[model samples]
Target: MATSNQGYIASELARNDFQNTYDLLVRACASHPERMAFSCGDSHLSFAELARQADALARYLRHGLGLQPGDRLALQLPNSLQYPIATFAALQAGLVLVNTNPQYTAAEARHQFRDSGARAILVLDRLLPLVRAVQADTAIEHILLTSVDDMENPRYDGDEPGTQRFMQALRIGAELPPVEPVAGLERLALLQYTGGTTGVSKGAMLSHYNLLANIIQTLELFGKPGLLEPATDVRIAPLPLYHIMAFATNCLGSVGMGLHTVLIRDGRNLDEIIEAMLRHPFTLLTGINTLFVGLMNHPRFGEVDFSHLKWVTAGGAALNDEVARRWKQLTGAPIREGFGLTETSPVVTTSTSISPHRDGYIGLPLIETELRTVDDDGHDVAPEQPGELWVRGPQVMQGYWQRPEDSAQALTADGWLKTGDIAVLDAEGFVKIVDRKKDMILVSGFNVYPNEIEDTVMCHPGVRECVAIGVPDARKGEAVKLYVSLKDTALDAEALIAHCRQFLTGYKVPSFVEVLDDLPKSSVGKLLRRELRDRARAEVG
Candidate 1:
């Protein structure tokens, strides 16, 4: 694949009829059978083991559970060996895998299960009670349960009518005939649910081609200069595999390159993450801004050896400049910020090792991707002018699952997926996000980007973290409110408000300031401005 001068992906990698997830897994096994494919703690699996277990599970899904092609199966496990095993198994069975967040409550799980029409769920045993509560409300008929220690030691304590042990299913399936690979690219492989901060969560339909295109595009960009040296590159896979960024990068990209990925179940646990880092000389690291900040702040982070670290990619949220700078200073590797949504196989633009990255700019669009900024009227915006970013690429999703109206609203008639993010395109084609359009504070018709306020406030030496949201006001129509968690408890709101005055206009300056312990964030560590907005509404009322 070759990139054009304008940053559009003009071509793609040549594949010898490798079309779907099943095909990719098959190729990985055949290419590097002895290579370590996935590892979590002491439990690990090679490419051959991954394929064998996946094929066994695939047979069980097809024959034992009587699940046919196109059936939905919810996967609610954390970042473990089972994640990739079940993922490949479900895809090979020709089943659409619904990647479920392990942190979801019963109601959220029910909504996803019901919406996706998932007939079965392969979940961790600890979360079985939550699934059992919602099982009657959804179409789910079978519950395949596995424990955290199942990978090391397979065990089944009980046998329920609809619920079975995950390891038992694999064992039973292994006794059956080997499953055959079905070739097709258009078929749906995953129904990855978008983080529903605005409204109810909707599943983004990702086809085999969509996922493959993204993996190849990312590899073409980051896989160069020893990014994916087989058996040599060890990736720190801390992000949940359920998310597209981790799934596509680790499950697909790393595995396809025949690399080893050490899966960390809980990345927020600083001690555990530090221990993982000390265990392996990881070549690559993938995570969000919050993870980076947490790692850099951890006292033991500097103690760990980072000699083997090569590339670090940050996504899922905006990377704080301070965090990126500190990371580079500590590790000597610049934090490459990428931009994408769940709809675009979760990767649209990123900084490569070969390219340079500006402070707040998301680097060039991936190969075969076309990104443009449009005004409210849908007309193209000029360079360096903030507008809604729209993207057209093979990696774009098919649409929202069973939500044609929502999909129609998000996608343009000409095939561009409206990213809903306000970004400015530089002369060099780098994109800098202003903020979410809905989160833009309108104070007396003046646009006040929360990102600007938050960034400024976060720059305060006393402030540990901060979030900005617009509140209803009778006089100004709306007013900016800053919520901050202080690094020093002695710092007061008046002092922080004065700090904001230095960098913001009168309208953009926060009218109200509140110091809290911490701000709300999504599972993936993205700041939740909507939660702050709701809190502001209630406080005002």
Candidate 2:
């Protein structure tokens, strides 16, 4: 018998645990077809309905649209009943999923769709204007449209060239001949585009094996009983379903575990999230640092029932200590913070409970995962010292899609993927994410991490949110400049600086402060430091 210490081998697990990504659905349908699988607003889809719909859509994608095996399909819809249906259908039909950001502008959308050479796209009807704006620039040959109102009919009834309603397509597909599942789990399943914050976004090539490894790894770490309570546990999916965190845990993991998932179309809407929690009393909540801060800060935060919450996992950004402590104090549920990137199938280290509490705590590496930190000399760093974190795991992505040179730069010959984030591993095997190596600032020969400054700044009561970035300085080479959004009290720049001085050293204190109504954020709500850096460069220019 294979012991748990050996961890999971994706190839063997594919043969034993489950067959493929779509197989998760197949098992769920067979076990409990009448149970609610997915819920959006007032509408719910049972496992049986989901199976019928996904198969129909899969047939339509294969035969009707002529999307052959290995073709790329861009999913531009938000968190709705349509997303899960499209996801499984595309996979079953042997198409690679290009998870597009629904909030993207025409230029961004065009860049992704054209770069991936996507042959078809499923977009929202309200975003038909965007499709009209960029359809000429891409390889998109067919359009499957859906609306928020009708699960069947799109709002854009106009016969735009190549446009068809998604539900109607599914209905038509049901009458077509059934298609066979693709062979091998090694085939590419998703082209997850990342690095948009740092530079030109490139698609990380994730095979079915990579996603399946993560799905099982997460279950292994936080499985059974109190954490993943099988059929009774309801997941409040406020994060966009397209994002790796929600996609792996909320969509795939939930379906695999027979858990009901409530999808929130707009996670930024605090009222909507609260209302969903009140209605369903969710046991799972997958969110980031900013969202936790926002929800706890909301006036009606106290109204939502926390009795049913068993898991509140944070990722996509570093978790602030203040926010974490406050969340636990209020909800009685510790936010199990994890860390990963799209390249690693979006999970590497996760914390269930930090026995020894520490800031930047991201627990241990997942099963069958190896982690290392190296200095600038490319040698392993001493324990408790900060260095670039590298990961080698079963879940690591195969490579970047169609960018061989870029892929080589990211993945070493031995299969180690350079994470580019600074981290420290304690003697106890605990991990702490110090900050991004690229985001570090140099102040008069001293290293200053923006996360440290921002974390300290966030301790103030009046500071709602803040982002710290380095700016050009004649004296210090690079000076720390802070941008903040206020919540309560009339604290000015000098007052906030004084507050910081009490906790931080002179060099770490902000040289300038700009109070803004809102700071730019990515679709996943991570603070966009690259955008801030660009703004600073433009200001100096």
Candidate 3:
């Protein structure tokens, strides 16, 4: 498949026929009824069972709880069987899904639910305290709760007063009449909120068509019959499903392809993750650079087998070429890197192979995806020049919910979504990310990208994790500052700077290097450059 200014989709790729995401689910169930659909903690749910349970819960939400079409339902749970079931059920019930991070604090939870105007929420039982603190601040009327073992061993009890067990909902919902389908595929299906690193998180309104398009585009690479083979390949799902990458790929795309997904309860639990890898001769993997680095650094990483591994997918952050090289070297499977954001249904471009990926470039846009790199004047930049990446596709969100001004600034009248990432198209037509537009450093009138500095730092065997941010500089206007956590204590900041000098230019080298116990990261393991930048500014003040 190739891209150009003409047809948005590559001529080689054919659009699949489907009503929407729900339709995709129904088809998967019908085709692979007896196949294992999901598994966690020695428990397995087949396609037939998943469909049955989701239908039951959907009926309960529609009739049993008096929920109506277009009502928003928040899903605030970790990676578990209940998450998939409840999400599909909510879809069948014609309720919009608000995928909430289970790690969210009360304040963050309040912002999402209140902003979405969610009427109901499905939460993990242990995390009910956050719900209690935020429920009063939201429009939440129905509370559905579940435990880690709710599917394996049903739990009927909770401390919260107005809550019901998720297992109980399944049992009751099983007896209700089948839920009717929502009228339009263009209707809103999900309210995926941004990470709020730069500012307040705004919900990007995604419709059923939006989701379906993303699923189809991604599936062209993952689904069909061979790549991520249905009912055969066991995929290791470590990233939180709430994140659009995991949500669109693992939760929907993988499962819709009829693959068995093993959810990692906590991505930080390297022991459990490695054990899961050993338990299932997993054929597929999905993760960001942080997750990949963590796994390979684990003491028992070499113990887990990669014999059955077909390939690995990386996204959610810039993939360090060094990290990709190491991962491929260790696993014997090449890492195909991709790039996207929450606004674009999370996938704007993906690599169909590892050729261009090893060069530290994000691959071509998905089928029918149009990309333009423009300067401040909205004019296209020359090849090998850096500019803001603008995207237009079926997968792009309609707009940020209820924020017309912010939405207007993000999207163009002609439909391009302004991705604030500075990128360049190499002579080979490969796209390489320079850095986030906000994180670019200006040193003596030269633009400096943190990703380059960080990638260079990560090449060091001593470094475990690192981030680069622009800090106040009296001489240069702004300087590059790097914060790192080390795997080798013998390595020091001075040594790191010296190492960077070997690869990076004088201006691009980090002016300041600080080694700490650990660097800050988001719940999904993406580095928090915004947090580091704020702290540096405060320190200067």
Candidate 4:
């Protein structure tokens, strides 16, 4: 799997000692048995204790739930201690883990469960209503629900009985029947879903080899002198686990290197997150640009300690110049912006601790990653010219799960993954994302597909045609703006907006809705999204 493009070789990354991500966990248990691996508020779990819990949960899934290898298990827990425990347990039991957002509506839940062919779900109790509504129609059979306090300290007596029941299941310790071992390197480890801009969200099939190679590559990238020592490194895990970037950089990356992780249960609770940071001085912190801005703007941010912080890496969205500068000025630490997608094991290029931090650039690709700027015809473009970024390496995902058409469109005939993002590559091999090819709106690091919103809006009888576009916002990276042509003369913007609330998420609902006599369209009747985007810019100005 070697390709020579741009004088760089793209080959399958050399495999590491760990068979799979779970194997890394097992090794961590052996090496740092007594060391604390994770902390969520007052509750802490050592590496050995974590491994034992995972084994118990794996046994429950196998003997009690009757789950088999390759079965999909949907997880909708927040960033609590239970998340990583359930995730590793599912992987250890040879089940494909499907990460789900806890805030999803019933419709969204149904779509994902059906699309992933998930047989069982381990969700928080608050989200049970959404699951119960869609459970009958989907393939989900087993339901294991937990409360918010399930993994929290027992002293906080909120829901003790429910937590006790859940713990009892894990402590039952049934003797699991022996089954044939599946090679961890070749097995599908996780099915991470990305919101498809043109169609339904498809699961990105990431194999164990892909994930393990990425962890090794990332470790090598950050292997600077005296910066990150595994025994002393402490990281903040505030980013959502459903996001591939957080899952890789914060969870697996820390565990692989025997680093301590401080889990933030709610990212929105800036006061609590800052308090935790002050209490436990972390060496490395990973989050999106918006999170950095939020922390800097918080009233109590100045009271927190930033002495132990060595690096702050930003991903999921582009870091704005003002936000980066403000963070550096406040904390005296530069915010390193990086580029990645769910397809590239969530990290393609990242700024290292050794590099002088800048605002816009996403730094250079990893040691074995090959990045090229290709034109529409699949021919390579010169450096400095903005074109679609094509990547080929061990970090790239195998393909979209059960989506041959999408997989074909995403990957080239020569095996290059055609990232729909427009970027320019410098002579030094640094890449900067200019624009997105798909009409996907990045609202606070979450992908809000225009098609999903348009479909929901079109359900209204008054709306004939609609186009959703992303408009720049001061706080959020982008806000959704919609232009619509009406079928009925009596329909007003307020009525249509009210109609949209019935089916769309709050973020997906158009912040600015305008009714038009006709929408701009090409001669062939295709909606001209570029024209609408230009109109949005003019309106914003």
Going through the candidates in the order shown, the clash numbers are: 1, 0, 2, 0
How high is each candidate's TM-score?
Answer: 0.81, 0.80, 0.80, 0.93
TM-score of 3: 0.80
Q: Give the distance in Å from residue 163's predicted Cα in candidate 2 to where it truly belongs.
A: 0.5
Alpha-carbon local distance difference test for all models: 0.82, 0.81, 0.80, 0.80
Task: Give a tens-digit lDDT track for model 3, residues 376-485.
Answer: 99999988889998888888999988889889989999999888889987665678888677665655334466776777789999999998888766434567889999
Which candidate number would show the highest lDDT if scored against the true structure? Answer: 1
Which segments of candidate 3 are over 4 A away from where they belong? 1-17, 157-159, 195-198, 223-226, 353-358, 439-541
> Highest TM-score, which number?
4
Model 4 TM-score on a 0 to 1 scale: 0.93
* Candidate 2 C-alpha error for residue 541, in Å: 26
TM-score of 2: 0.80
Per-residue CA lDDT of candidate 2, range 102-174, in tens?
Answer: 8666666888899999999998888888877888899998988888755633343546666898867987899
Which window of 10 residues has the lowest lDDT sum in candidate 4?
1-10
Over 251-369, each residue of candidate 4 has an lDDT whose tens digit, in order, gives 78878778899989887788878988888878888887778888888888989888878879988877898887888788877778888889888888887668744447898887678
Q: Any idea what lDDT model 1 has? A: 0.82
lDDT of 1 by residue, 54-120 (tens): 9999999999999988999999998889999998898888899999878766666888999999999
Deviation of model 3 at 246, angstroms:
0.8
The alpha-carbon deviation from the true structure for residue 240 of candidate 4, after best TM-score superposition, in angstroms, is 0.9
Better of 2 and 3 by lDDT: 2
| Clashes (candidate 1) | 1
Query: Lowest summed lDDT over 10 consecutive residues: which window, candidate 3?
Result: 7-16
Ranking by lDDT: 1, 2, 4, 3
Judging by lDDT, tell me the better candidate of 1 and 2: 1
